[model samples]
Target: MDQRVTIEIIDGVADVRLVRADKMNALDNAMFDGLVEAGETLKLNKQVRCVVLSGEGRAFCAGLDASNFGRMAGGGGGGEPENATSRLGPRTHGISNRAQYAVWVWRELEVPVIAAVHGFAYGGGFQLMLGADMRYVTPDARLSILEIKWGLVPDMAGTQLMRHLVREDLVRELTYTGRIFSGAEAQQMGFATRVCDDPRAEALKVAREIAGKSPDAIRAAKRIYNAANYRSAADGLMDESIEQSSLIGSPNQVEAVKANLEQRAPRFAD
Candidate 1:
């Protein structure tokens, strides 16, 4: 995890960075483990009110590491080769397999997560970005649903997340062709929340702003929003009330109101 990903938490926000810069922060076995571990850590840490995810160096991620392809071609590689078929039957982390959990865990977090993407986000990396609640990207960054180029379907929760973001026809087109698109196009197509000159800085700014809110309320908001796509309207409405009831008059909630009335920043407890 240390070799591939790094985490730093400050003032209720966690900055999670992909550190394998030399290979464009590609998703190797270590990277997969690191991402999953980071997500799990943040999920259990109530002090983390928001998260910003980004990669070091020129690209966000170039999808699977090239060595994995070499291994598939019967060449020598750094680590043991993975058996794709062997992963299909079991739910390694509740509803996801090892690969899928590397991406899906971010979505499972109660606090908001923002992905700051630059350069290339392809194949598995593209799916990884989808796990975040919002994405801030560079206008010139390249993105693609690239698994088709290697004759494989997206197996890391891409199919599930894409439906919530883009039109059916567009998703089908991208999946079938493996064509690249710019981040500006991604925003227009609903894949990105915004395109910025420096995505990481912008994402950090937004994360800090979120961190200033009542932690309980922020978490409840994420839960309510996440439920919109998966739950029936009746269930969603009931959950909204239940969540709100839990937050109303809570210590953090009272602090938020007091701070607003006093014109000062709220001092919230985790």
Candidate 2:
């Protein structure tokens, strides 16, 4: 994992950084494994109230490593013939394949995840960012759904996540054109939460604020909001009441109220 990703937790916030600076943090086999492992570890850590994901390099990620394209062009890198078929067909992790899971795991994490995007986020890199609950990007950052350029589709949960953030017509346009857009344009298109001069610092600041909230309430809010996207209005409304019911009178809930009343910071339990 140290080869591709690194994690550090401080003050209830986990900072996850993609560390393949030499390759612009592009996704290779090791990078995929590292990402899944990081997400899994953080998912089980109840002490983690929030997560901030960023890449340490010139770009957030340049999509699949260039070596992958070379392999495809040579038609010699598709792992051992017998294993290739099974790899594509198996739903090894519930509804996702291994590659997809690398990105999907963030969405499944109970705590909110924020992405700090700088430089470029293209193709699979863009999809990975979509898995986050919020994204803060530098104004000059470039992003694109670039698989079409390689005669491929956005297979890394892009179709699923894009629909939620971008309009159908625009998604189609971008996917078909594989055109890069600036972060400012991305914000206008609703793909980014904010555009800043320093996305990493801004993202960390917001992550700290989120960490200060009652963990129970924050987790409940994430669950409820996620349900709103995938569930029917009736089901979503029911979920709201159910989540609140569990939070009401809970230790953290009471502490949240008491803190606000006393104008002091809440000391929540893990």
Candidate that scores best on TM-score: 2
True-structure RMSD for candidate 1: 17.9
Q: Which lDDT tens digits does candidate 1 get at residues 120-190?
A: 99999999999899999999999999866653557677777888899999999999898999999999999
For model 2, the run of ten residues with the poorest summed lDDT: 232-241
Return the TM-score for candidate 2, rounded to 2 decimals.
0.83
Q: Which residue pairs show collisions in model 2?
A: none
lDDT of 2 by residue, 98-147 (tens): 77788879988999999999999999999999999999999899999987
Give all TM-scores, in the order shown: 0.82, 0.83
Q: Give residue 270's error in model 2 in angstroms.
A: 60
lDDT of each: 0.81, 0.81
Cα lDDT of candidate 2 equals 0.81
Listed per model in order, the count of residue pairs whose N, CA or C atoms clash below 3 Å is 0, 0
RMSD, one per candidate, in order: 17.9, 17.9
